[model samples]
Structure formats: C-alpha cells, structure tokens
Target chain A: MTAGATDKAGISWLPGRQAGLALLLAPALVYYFVVLFLPQLEIATASLMAADGRFPVDTNFRRFVTDPFFLSILWRTVRLSVISTLLAVIVAYPIAIYLSQPWRRWRAVVAFAVITPIMISAVARSYGWVIILGPAGLLNQAITGLHLGTDPQHLLYTETGLVIALTHLHLPFMVLPITAALQQIDPSILRASRILGAGSMRTFWRVTLPLTLPGITAGATIVFCLNGSSFVTPALIGGARIPMMSFLIYQQGLDVRDWNFASAVAIVLLLSTSTIVIAHLIWSGRRQRRAAGAA
Target chain B: MSLPLTSQVFLEVEDLALSYGKSAFGLAGASFSARKGEVIALLGPSGCGKTTLLNLIAGFLVPDHGSIRVAGRSLRGVPPHRRDMAMVFQNYALFPHLSVEKNVAFGLEAHQVPRQEREPRIADALAMVGLSDSRTRYPRQLSGGQQQRVALARAMVVRPSILLLDEPLSNLDTLLRKSMREEIRQILDRTGITAVLVTHDQEEALVVADRILLMSNGKIEQIGTPEEIYERPRTEFGARFMAVENIMAGSVCSGDTAGTTVNTAIGQFKCTPCDVVTGANIKIAVRPERMHIVAATSGSQSYENRVTGRVVRSTYHGTYRRLLIAVHGMELIVHAPVSSDDSEYSGDVQLTWRPADTHVLLQ
Candidate 1:
C-alpha cells in the first residue's frame, strides 16, 4: 500500500518539477545576464581595441603593461590595500574579542558605533576625514596648540591619508566576522585550557586563535578586495597627488575620455583583486583539508 | 616559625562563601577536606552549589570568605594554571581543531615539557585510556564514551596534584554511564591521584566515589563514605536524596533493651536505638527495597514492625515489581523481586521490616 501511494505521488510530482524549477530560476538568470554578464562582455571587447577604436589585439594591454606611470599606480593600489587590510585586522581583533564577551550590557553600544560609518555615505565619511586631517583641521590645531610640532603636517593628499580612510571604512567588515567566529567558541573550551595549565596568552595562541582563523580569512579577503577596488575615498581624500588604479581608471574614462584605456585598467584591477581573493581561498581550503585529514 | 613535617589532608577548603549579586543561590560556608588518593564526589541536585564549589577549587571563581590549601600550602592568589590542578569538563571540551594526540599533549606543552619526553608520555596516557589506536582521530569523530576517556587521559597526563571532574558521566547513556562509572573508579585507583567529582546522580556517586559529600542549598548536609551516607543519613534531605521513600513523623514513646518505640499515624514503630528523649518528636526513614510484602493470610507472623494495607498499584519492572500500598492514609512504596509467582495482589497486604532498617534522622 505504501509503495503504491509513493508511486502515485511520484507520478504527480514528476511532470511539474522541471517547469517549476525553471519558473523559480527565471528572475535570477535574467538579472545576472542583464546586470553583470552583458556589461562585462562589453568591457572585455572594448579593452582589446586601439586608441582609434579599431580592432587591435594587444595595443591597450601592451601599453598598460609597459607604462611605468600606470605600473606604479597599480603597485601603489595593491600595496595600500594590503596595508589597510592588515591595519583593519590588527585594530578589529581586540574589539571583536571584547564584543564577544558574555556580558552584553555595553556590547550593543560599541557594535552600533562600529557599524555607524557603513550607514553613512562614503563621500560624506571621506569629507568628514578631510575636516579632521586637513591643515588647520582639529588635529593640526591641537598639535600646534600643544607645540608638539612647529608646522602643520600635510596629511590630506598622501597615500597615508588614503590608507587611513580605507582602513576606517573596512574595519567593521573585519570585526563582524571575527566576532561571529569568537562567539561560536564554547566558553568551556577556554576554561578547559586554563585548567589544563595554559595562561591567558598561551590559551589564546594555542586554542582561540587557531579556531577563529576561518573568520579572519573571510574578513581579510572581503576587506582586501573592497579596499583595492575603491575609488570614492581616494578621489575625495588623496586628491590628485596620490594616483591609485581606481583613480586612474576614473580619469581615463571620464576626464580624458579614453574608453579603451579605462576598460583595460578596470580589467586589470578586477583580475588582481580576484587573484588575491582566490589565492587566499585555495590556501585556506588546503589547510582545512589537511587538518581534517590529520584528525 | 616552624612548619609541620607531614600534613595528613591533601586538600582542604575552609568556610567558603559566595553570593550571586542579590540572589541567595550561592555557596554559603561550605567546608570539606580530602586525604591523598581519595576520590570524593560532591553529590547534590541542581542549584545546590556543587558546580560552584568545583569552580571555586579550580580557580574559575573566587570565594568571598574562604581559603583553600593543598598539601599544607595556602592557595591564595594562585591562578588555575599555576595551581597545578587538572579538570575533566562535563562536555569533554576537547580542542576540535587538534588531533587526540595534540589534545592530550596540551598540558605538557604548557608546562614546557620537551618534545622528546612529551611523545612517550602522550602515548602512555592514550594507552592508559585504551585509545592508543584512535589518537589521530578528532574528538568529533569519536563516540561519547571514547571522548570521555580521552578527556580523562588528557587530565591524567599532566600528573597534577589533584584532578577535578564536572558531571563526567552525566552525558552518557544509562548502560554506558554504568560502565564508565566503573572505568573511572578503576582509573582513579590505578593513578592514586586525589580527585573531586561533581555529580547529581546518586547511583553514580554510590558506585564511583570513595566518599560522598551530600549537599543542599549551598551547604554540606553530610559527608561520609558511600555506605555510611546511604545506610545512615543525618538529615531529612540526605535521606530523601538517598531514595528513602518512606518517612514517618512520630514522637518517642519509650526506650528499652529491645529498641526505641515511636508512636505515629500508622501505629507504633520499633526503630533502632537513637539518642532521643521520651516524648520528643522525631522523623524516621525506610528505604522502599527494605520493605517486604507478605500475604494477608499469614497471621501472627513474628516481625519487628508490620502494617496491613491495600495494594493501590503494582508495576512490573522486569527484574523487580514495584507496588504502591495505601497504609493508614499514607502511600508507601515497596519493591519486591519478580518471581514466577509474581501475580498482582489485590485487597489487603501486609508489609514487614526489621527494627534495624528504620533510620532515625535527628535533623
């Protein structure tokens, strides 16, 4: 009797399953093609064209690779993004640990403060940093007033300014993931470590840090990719003095009207960022496999 | 000042007290001691400060007004790691990222034991727990009993002066718990390391511990050997906790060479001699298994104490049958061994017990 009922149910379900799945998947497929694939294909095709809009195989690519000016900008972008990610990780780790404590009366307040910048527009946040780090800004005024330095420092249009702004923008991304990982750790594990004769530092190094590496990897990948491709913060804070890959792409596309060069630079930026993220994923995946196999 | 040459007690806790904010559910002046190589089980119900006392001794929590001493040395201001004690957590908090070998080697690494010495010790510890073949497996891959054994091996590898266990067998199934109870007893005997175990299961305590420290409401109700704590309870809570089902309030009528007679709602009962004045009110307890059921037609049988009642309920419990009898407005439970003639007895039934079986709780 059960077999007959199951066969009847299977017969009724089989006919509609294909049509039902296609109907459910239609919107996502359409959105992906229209929003992502079509524009990317256009950019790829345009990147291969010469300056005269004729089909040339390697003109723009060769120019981008050989030009020392563009090479320095690309290197600077990658270096600054790496630095900003490291700074964000260093600053966010302790805050994540504090926020993951069992006591929760003040965690909500600190978490709101950490996430408040993401709610505001990036342009507005960059302008706020401008007021803070500019000459005769609040910091300079304090420095001059305290006689710590004879002259006001020029921090407004430098790579240091860009890194500081980018780090501030991506700090929350680093903190939230690490905090989630920290919270997943059982409190008994920490207590067990202590009872087994590990001091606080040794316990964290031996147990807590290894357990939370997945979260750190996720947060670092996101922050690195986001900061690498960011254009708004650099344009507003670093001005024309610091030349990042994103700013170069923006200049070629809009200021000089060099569409081919702009597309080439954009492709380069996408490839480099994806390379870092993919490499990290591969390394962490191998580590996880090794750990599982050892166990 | 001269120090004592030899100290008899291995671990001593004096006048420990703690309070949880405004709540009264915290340890209040609990004191106990353990000799070297003794296994003491802190047996109590939930919210009775057994775990809290364990935490206090482990340095996870500080006592508000007390001091702990190990081997005549005061343990004030000593952190958990520096105190040289090990613990087996209830959930067996093995490091999920590490293999079993690394988990057992963690304490040795903490103490800066050299790698050359650590490998052999780890191997021996794993072999002692009978998990030498599974040392490379993660804790998640092992069974519950295997994980518990790993936890035990990890604690023992450090060779600490004392070991603490927090509800170690409560996480296992009934049959596994019984076997693990015997395993823990054997391990403690072999190691001869002073240990303190926390458990709420009376049967587990009875099987595993050398001495039982029964607690109630953050206070030590009684402390004695397992046989003593089971056969003779000093307080009503201790009696009830030991599964003594029948308790009757009565006043002492008289004392003679035979025994002391107490008059109760279920008629007079002759109990073992206790230091109680005549006409003083007292309470007495009898275990359910001690009460024997006989046929109502057995007339004038010579029994120290006898009562007749109707069998209200009878339950077949495989090896034994439990019968609830209504006796003089009070219900009494009787556990009888199941035999071939184990048929339901209706109507009147007589329950008999020796005078020595009645335990008098003075408090």
Candidate 2:
C-alpha cells in the first residue's frame, strides 16, 4: 500500500478522530455564531421591517436614501474620516522613521508616549482635547501670551476639534506598523545608496518611501475604518454643530427610540466600509502581482 | 621621507588615526597609497582594522587625524555621496524592491543623466555583467552569485574614481569563491579601475591582489607582492600568517661574510646573511614544502641544515601527504608529494634544507 493511503486508513480507523477535530474547532465556531453572526442577522432583519412590525418592508432604507439630512451626515462622516486618516499619516511617518533608528532608550520613551493616549478612556481623552481647544485653555493662553493673535479663536464644538481628536486617537495605529516595516529594512541598503551617489533626499524618495508602502496602506486602512465608525469623539467635540453618521445612528436608536431606522443606518455604514476595504485589497493585490511579474 | 607627487597616484591616505569611543588603542597612524589602475588588497585577520580603513576612505567614518586625498585633492568635509568612490558590499546589498535594470540606473538618475543616455549605460552595465536577460528580475529572484554580479554592475556603472570592496567573496562556498575570485580579478583588470579590497583569505589575496598589504592588530606588518610575501617575510607574524609552519627560536652563535650560524633546541643551523650581532636572539622560519625528507639510511648528508626525527603522524591529503615529525620533543610538520615509492617510509627520517631557504627574524 502507498504511505499516504495507509496513513489515511489508520487515521480513519481510530475512534473519535473526527470528533476530536470537531472538538478542537467547537469554541471558535460557537463564539462566532453567538457573538457576531446572531446580532448581524437580527440587525439585517430589523433593518427591513416596518415601524409597526406588521411585515418586512424597505421603509427605513427608503427614508435613509431620500432624506437629504441623512445623506449629508453620511457624506460628512466619510470626508472627516478621510481627513483624519491623512492627518495621522502625516504626523506618524516622521515618528515611525525616528523609532526605526538605532537609538534604543529614546525610541522606547517616544513609543510609550505615542501609545499612552490609547490607554486612557476615549471619553476622558475627548474631554482632554476639549480643555485644550477651549477659549480659556492652554492653546489660547499660549497664543495670547506669544502675541501671535489679538483674540482667542473658538475651536471647541467644531469639525476641526473632532478631526484633531480622532487623529490623535488613531496615531499609534499608523506609527506602529510603519515602524515595524522600517525596522525590517536592511541598513546596508541605505549605505549602498549613499555609496552609489544618491543623496539622502533621493534615497528616501526612491528607496525608503516605496519600501514602506505596505505599512502605510495597512495603517491607513485601520485608521479610516475606526474613525468612520467612531461615535464618542464626534459627539463630544463636534457638539451637534457638525453631524456624523455615527451620531445620527446613536440618536435614532437610543434617544429617539427608533431601533429599525438605527439598524438600517448601521447596515449602510457596514456596507460602505466593507466596500472600501475590499477595493483597497483588490488594488494592493494587483500591485503585488505586477511586482511579481516584473521579477 | 616623501615620494614625489605624480599624477599616477590615484589615492593616498596619510597618518590616518581613529579610536573607538575613548579607548586608547584603535587604528593609529596608518598610511598607504595606490596608483592608477592598481588593485591593493588589505589582507588581515578579523579585528585588524582592514574594514575600518576602508570605511575611512569611503567617508563613512571620518579619521581623527590625517587626510585622504584623491588625485592629489584632499577629501575633507566631503560626504560619501559627494565623494567619487563606489563600494561593493559584502552582502551584495541589492535593493529588493527594484529590478536589476533600475538598480543599476539609480546612480545615473541621481546624477541627472538624460534618459536616453541612462538607457544605453544601463544596458551596457547589464551586458558587461552578463545579466542582460535578467534585467527585469528583482534581487530576491536571483541566486547569490547572480545578485553579486548585479551589485558589481551597479557599482561599476557609476564610473567612480575609486572602487572599494569589503570581503566581496566571503559569502560564497569554497568552489564558488575560487571561481569568483578569478572572475573579479579579470573584471578589475579589464576595467583598469584603481581598487582596494579587504579580505582575510590569504589565498584570495595572493590570487586577486597586485599587491598585498598584510596587517595585524590595527597595524600594517608588511606590504609586498605575493611572491615577496611568500618567500621573504620580515616578521614572525608575517611568516606564521603565510603558513610557513616551521619556526625555530635560537640565538646567534657567529656571523661572517659567508653566512651566520644559530644554536637552537634541535641543533646548530646555518642561516643566510642577516643583520644580527653575535649573541643576539633570533628566530628562523621555513615553508613546509621546502623541506626535503629522505630515509635515515640515505647518503645525502651534505646539506647545510639537517635534523633527524621520527614520524609521529601522517595524513593523506589526496595530492600530498602531511607528516608530523617529533624532533627533540618538538613537533615539526612536513609536506611530501604523494608517490608510490615514498609511501612505505614510516619510522625515522632525515629532513634537510639549504641555508638559503632559512629566513632569519631578528625581532
């Protein structure tokens, strides 16, 4: 008999072998069904049901599509999330590069500082931003003390405040992945570039930037998804002056007691986020294929 | 003493010194020069400042003292990118994200060469390295030797004033190392580029370098051609490094116009003319292959230096037999050519060499 056939027969001959495989997968399967699948299925069903709960209809979805107020909230949510992700990337790139250097002690200190905000509660962190962006807060005090402007500008309860808070919240996610990518790069490659008559700026543009694309894409993806679905920071810092999709969903479900409409909004948010993520995946996959074909 | 300045002097490093941190004993007062179209090998063991010296010349590490000159121009305050020198790293250092063609064209692009000119130069470099077919391949797609060739092409494409290599063949297998060493020598000769190579392999230095600068403990021990280094080592370290296995310590007994006599543990031996006073301490060295072995009963007893020893161990090395002999409680290694008739001799043998073969080290 062939070795493969004999091994298969022996495995099948043992009692409870299949049961053992089932047992190994039981916990994860059960957890996924109870915690994730059930809630999503209920939301899908509720999103289609009418307000009187008589029969399934598309009333909530129709309202969502036809109402100009809901449409504007969705658009604003997308725009703000994109801006926050870009801001995080701009702030994190230099920090990631610095952390990738060989300075051990300083890197540890800076890394701790970057991740410290995440350890605090999101509400508390939002309040901290409120204190700083308030009229009588530290920023206005510094501006007036430095004589840079005549009056203290009102920054709280605005889209700018929300963007700043969201960017700070997601900064660590952006820096960590890029730092890992930078650290994986071989130091001799940089030295070789310099020896081959490339200045530091050229080396960064040609070699460093291209090599770190995977990390940047990963970090941007994470920040975009999280900020798009976030509820707390926008509610506190934006203060109804700028309405986002998450705040409207919260208002519909809990404050107004419209569970069906809330479910519909949640479904829309999930669909749009999934669409963007899948598109990004396809684009990056094509790039990887092109790279391989060239090789 | 200073040599006359000539346009042929491509690179000159004078009184270069550097120390790691505050340590008092790093590379000190090293000076060397290379002429145009000459390949100089910095031959030494590990931790012998060979790589440090290369880094200094490449402007990666600034010297604490002295100056490096290229074609009689001082290279002070010049960054590595501005310095007209290229280096082939030991690990090849090919960019994983770039294709072979793009990697070779990187230097030209940095220098702002026109696109039309760059394309032809890139093609020429790839053709020279015999990788024209693999131009679109990335570094990860090539074998170790192929990646090394790509690195060589990239470095040479710049047409820099000097080329530096740091143990370029150290990562290859033994058989590949031999072939690559010869290939590198051929490439350098064809290009006529002034190059400095750092390596610890004596055989590689002997084969590839036009001149070898032997170093020890951050100091140069000797500088000479391969033949001179093999035949006439000036110090004990140089002799031992060259694999001259027979070294004997003794004191000078007498000196004359003809030759000198030295007394040692084995016997008094006559040596070639050397500058040493009578009663001064000395050491003598000779290569194993230069010693002749004969049966104890043979009638060849007229040699100047002779010793009687018993064979302690013998090893068969396919082409030759290496025999260890016990003479006066000291073991001496001797290499004898493998032959049908000489394989039978075992116990007692007489070794002899002419006085001219003995190298006297007075230090």
Candidate 3:
C-alpha cells in the first residue's frame, strides 16, 4: 500500500482518465444512437404527430388505425411478403439441400451457378425478368415455341409479377442461411440414423428437417423483410399500379412531399418487419430449447 | 427345414476377398463359419482386414470374389438394413438425438414392428444390458461403458439373423473392457444369437470367442478355437501374433522320421515335423510360457533340446519375470512365473523344453 500510494502520488495529476475511456467509445456510441436507435425513436414520435408537425396531445395513431386505405396497404405489404417468402423458401430448400451434400467439387460449381443472379445488379436482374415476363418475352416465346400454349401468356405487371421479382431477388438470402444451417449438422448423425434401421426418407423427415429449422426460420425472416420493403424490383417489374408500401412511402415523402404521412408509414413498416423478425427468432429459439431439453 | 441347434451354421463367409481399387488389397480369401449361439472373434493387428471381414458379413460391404450367406441365403445385393443383422461399432455410433430407449427401438420401428410389441422389446433389451435406469438418458449423458451397453442393447433389440460387433470393447479402458467383454458374452449367450466380433487383443479374443479367426496380410492365417490358435499355432505369423517366442530360421539337419532336428543358431533342437518336410527351409515357433528353466547340467531326465543363454535383462511384471535371453546372437523372450519357493534364475540360465512343445512352420 505504501509503494502504491507513492507511485500514485506522482501520477495523481493526470487528467481525463475517465474522459479518455468515454472519448475512445464516443464515436461508436454516437453512431449507434444517431444511425439506429435515434432514427427509430424519431420515427415513432413522428408517427404520433398531427399534420401540424408536432406530436399530438391525443393518440394520432388513430389515422393509421381508422383508415381502410392504410389498412389495405399494410395488408398488401404483409400478403406480398408472406407469398414471396413462401415461394423463396419452397424454391431455395431443395437447392440448399443439394448444395449441402458431400460432393464438394460439384457443390462449389453448383453453388456458384445458383447464386450467379446475385452477382448481377438488382436493376439489371429485374430487367432480365422483364424480358422474360413481357408478352413477346423469351418465356412466352418458349411456351408458344413448344406449342404448350395457344397464345402468349399475360404474365407481367401484376401481384404475381411482383412476387416473382421479390422471390428471385431474395432467393440467395433463403438458400444461404439454410445451407449454413444444414452444413452444421454432423454427417455421422445421418449415417448413424441410417444404420439404426431408418430408411433414407424417414431419417430426413425425423432428423434433417427439424435440425435445420433454425436456418429455415432465418432464411424466411430475411426473405420476408426484403419482400416487405421491396421497391425497385417491384416498381420496375410490377409497374406503379401495384403500389407496395415502399413505393407509397417514397411517393409520399419525395414525390408528393408529405413528410409527416411518409414518416408514419415508414414507422409502421419498420415496426411490422421488426415484429416478424423477432417473432420468428423467438419461435426458432423456443423450438431449439425444447429440442435441447428433450435431448 | 432347420437343422438342430448344435449342427446349424448361422452365418457362412466363404473365400471373401475385398479390394478398394485396382491395386490395394483389403481382404484375400478369408473364409469362416459361425454356428448358432456362438461368438466368433476375428483376432488380428490393425490393417489385418479384421474389420473388412466383419463388414463383409454385416452386409455393409460386398466381396469382390466370394459370397456371404446367412441362414443359407446369399446376401449378394442385400442392403445392410435388409440383411436382418445389427452391428455394434467401435465408436458406439448411438444416435445422439435418440434416448437409450429410442435407440434400442430404432430397429423395431424400421421393421415396422407393431407399436404394442416394440415397447416391451425395448424395455427387455434395455434391461438385459442393465441400462433400464438410464433408458431416458441421451447418449452424451452416459459414460463410455454405459454407451457401449446402449449400443449392445440397440443391436440385440433387433433380434436379427446375426450380430456383428466390430471391436466394440476396444474403446473401453482395460478394467472396463474386461468386465464389458464378460457382460457382452453373457448377453449374447442369453440371447442365443450367433455373433461375430473383431478384436486385436489376444486376451479379449481368448476370453470371449468360442473360436478365434487369426488373420494376417489380408488372408486367413489360421482359424480355430483359442486353445488351437495359442497352444497349437499352425503358421509362423499366427504364432508370432499370439505372443509365441523363439521363432528361429534353420534347416533340417536330421532326416530320420521320429522328428526332424533343426540345426538352428540357438543350438540344434528337435522339432515335431507336424507340417514341415525334411531338408527344407523352415521356421520353428514356440511359446515363451511353455519354456521352462531347468538345472541343465544336473538334471537326471534327458531332454530333446537344451539351450545355454545369458539373461541380458529380466523385468518382473507382477505375475511373471519377462527374461530377454541372448542365445547364440538371438534374443528369446521367456515368460518365467514368479515364485518365492522356486530359485530365481537371474543371469546365465539354462533353458530347456520338450520337442513336442516346438511347432515347426515351413517357410
């Protein structure tokens, strides 16, 4: 204690020791508050504000609560997100399963091919979809060429077209998570299951699917969130008539200059997306806990 | 038409040969048969193709040039699950996700055994392995011995045509391995199921197997009861594998038919010409435990062979003193029993044995 006191005696004049720690972390703290937490808080406050640009004394949540137009917009966003997420999951699962197999050389090649669409610009990818979705597009031409249809199909600028675009855009998000999850499973577990009298199909159903649920949940959440906020791909491929939430938010804030209304819509969309992500995470967590408990 | 229990051949593998590729040979001309209610152990060192032989019988592998027939039906293209056989792996290989009960019940479910029948079978199998108390425990929760018991329960629960155990006890510690070996033997006997086991440990094979199949360099060196493989080894490789000492290279010096006397460097020794011919290059094999140290110069009895050697080193290993004797530039390991009454031959001991103890192996 005497030696420590003697050493501290000379260094006692040192200033900003506590301040230095805060100074070191100030940038990250400020960035987190300003970029993330503060924006969310501001949006929440702005959503509760009246048309006068001041937060309402009463609950102006009534605007979003009472308007059927806003309710329909919300429904459309959720409906599109659900459909697109479902499609993405359905298409991505088998591809992820194939990629997760033991063929490393071919896995690399096939994985690259599956994800090659992601390498192209999203705009360019949507345009390629346009070429396929157009009446004179390659898909219709192929259908006519094959004599599978009597006429060029009416495939473009609809909810179906938007769903198709959203699915294509978010397919990688689904496959990547599922693939990662599937890869973590022990190969020996499968072999053991097979030896223990399980047929291949039964083993997959009883073991593989349940073990990879976390990944499926993660992939679905990503695809859903992306589909919910989707603007460019839908606008380019689905046309302005579809009017997803992102397109409406953009129209109100930038094109129509209705900042308060746009902020309210943005806040609602953000809350919906966060709620879905959190709910999925919670469900997956509960399932994993139960599995662990059983094991 | 089923043969009587004692006369029935449960599984037969005739001339089984396996090779992975064009040049690499796995097992060559391996042939053996197991009878009902008997446990046959395949005893060999690593890479001696013991596991390959077990795999062949278990239907996990197909032989390139022979056949496996269980219950007189050729399992040429039968998948492992379809072969009506179960195996206990060296690693245990119990399903990690399944509880002990479920692991045992897996085969029942696979065979589509009615749910009402499966529960009791699972319970009985688990109880047989003394794992009833831990039936609900996962594999990771059990000890190594417990896991092995679970694996045994899983294999036995199936009540398959035959059981294949691929070095199942090799993963256990010495004391546990000994106890589990007895436990498994008792279980298999109680079930009256024909079983095939592969192990590299001589003691384990001797203790457990009704008959031991000795393999060497991808071939069946010898196949016989433990006593035959040990006391009456037919090949030099077989004798060496069983801890038999004093393998000597020599030529037959005597042609008369009572026996052939080989003029070996250790000294000229009389050997029973059981398999070797006179005037032929041969190797003589003898067990170290069979050799006795006698008062060579003072003995009233006349022995067939006697060797004078200096004990280079003597190590007392609790039950016996393993002596390394240098006799005419060759080292012979002799296992001499420890006794307080017997005079200890520490250095420069005279070793002698009867001619019948010597088995001649033709090179």
- Give lDDT per model, in order: 0.89, 0.87, 0.81
Per-residue CA lDDT of model 1 for B1-363, tens digit only, reads: 111336378899999999898665699999898888888999999989999999999999988999999998999889999989999999999988888999999999998888899999999999998999998888877889999999999999999899999999889999999989998988888888899999999998988888899999999999988998999887899999999989999999998766789998998999988888899999989998889887644453547899989989999888788889999889999988786666536668888998888877886
Per-residue CA lDDT of model 3 for A78-187, tens digit only, reads 99899999999889989899898876668888788778877988888899889998899998999999999988887788788778878988899999999998898876
Please write out the lDDT profile of model 1 over residues A1-295, one tens digit for every residue: 2567785565354347577678879999999999999999899999998888789578888899999989988999999999999999999999999899968788999999999989999999999999988998887899999999989988899888788899999999999999999999999899999989999999999999999999999999999998998888998987668888988988999999999989999899999889989999999998877667541
| Model 2: docking quality category | medium
DockQ of each: 0.69, 0.63, 0.30
By DockQ, the best candidate is: 1
Superior candidate under lDDT, 1 versus 3: 1
How does chain A of every candidate compare to the true chain A by TM-score? 0.90, 0.89, 0.83
Per residue, candidate 2 scores C-alpha lDDT tens digits across A14-118 of 467678778879999999999999999999999998889955898999999999989888888888999999999899999999999986669889999999988
Reference-based TM-score of each model: 0.94, 0.92, 0.86
Better of 1 and 2 by lDDT: 1
Q: Which ten residues in a row have the lowest lDDT in candidate 3 chain B?
A: B294-303
Q: B145-209 in candidate 3: lDDT tens per residue?
A: 99999988888887877888888988899999989988887887777788889999999899888
Ranking by lDDT: 1, 2, 3
What's the best-to-worst order under DockQ?
Answer: 1, 2, 3
User: Model 2 over residues B10-34: C-alpha lDDT tens digits?
Assistant: 8898988888875533677788888
